[model samples]
Target: MNTTSLPKPNSMEFDIHAKLKAANSHWSYCYAVHPHDKGFDYQFNTTFVGEMEFAVYERIENYFVLVDFFKSYDEACDDAKKIIDDHPDIKKMFSVS
Candidate 1:
């Protein structure tokens, strides 16, 4: 069996480019709560279907804060898993239903 190891993720993410778009720009996405969410309607949104369009996202306080646009959804999922596993408190603090 040939298995490749995933790259180590950083504790903090940095943005290389700032979005300098006009205010109130239109966006397209779907909002979904975390699989373990069981609280309020706080949710995360994805611009594309993860498996079909290869989008990965991170949620914070009812917002999909981090967008892995270029990264594959699978890769982004692996990284997100690492983050959640490393800090279990995130789920409890900001769980969405």
Candidate 2:
């Protein structure tokens, strides 16, 4: 099987990383798509490392806290958007006026 024969994606929106200020601190919070690794598995390591997934995380001081993961890009983006839109603190963190 030649994986290279597959058509390229029409858009790269999934690769866009959204970084925002933490609600309670000066640290950063980000959500983005990444390839699966040994650390995370949706079904007991059934998925390979090449598989793409979305992750939401927060950086506090010198450490990071993983919030959630989504199998699809849309799912992750939607949830992040909802969180910002529905929460006053999160919404205000956005630089866009």
| Model 2 ranges with Cα > 4 A deviation | 1-50, 77-79, 82-97
Number of backbone collisions per candidate: 0, 0
Per-residue CA lDDT of model 1 for 41-60, tens digit only, reads 33323343332222334555
TM-score of each: 0.27, 0.27
Q: Please list the C-alpha lDDT of all candidates, in the order they appear.
A: 0.38, 0.36
Tell me which residue pairs clash in candidate 2: none
| Tens-digit per-residue lDDT, 4-74, candidate 2 | 21222246443322222111222223323344433431211112345443344544333344443443334
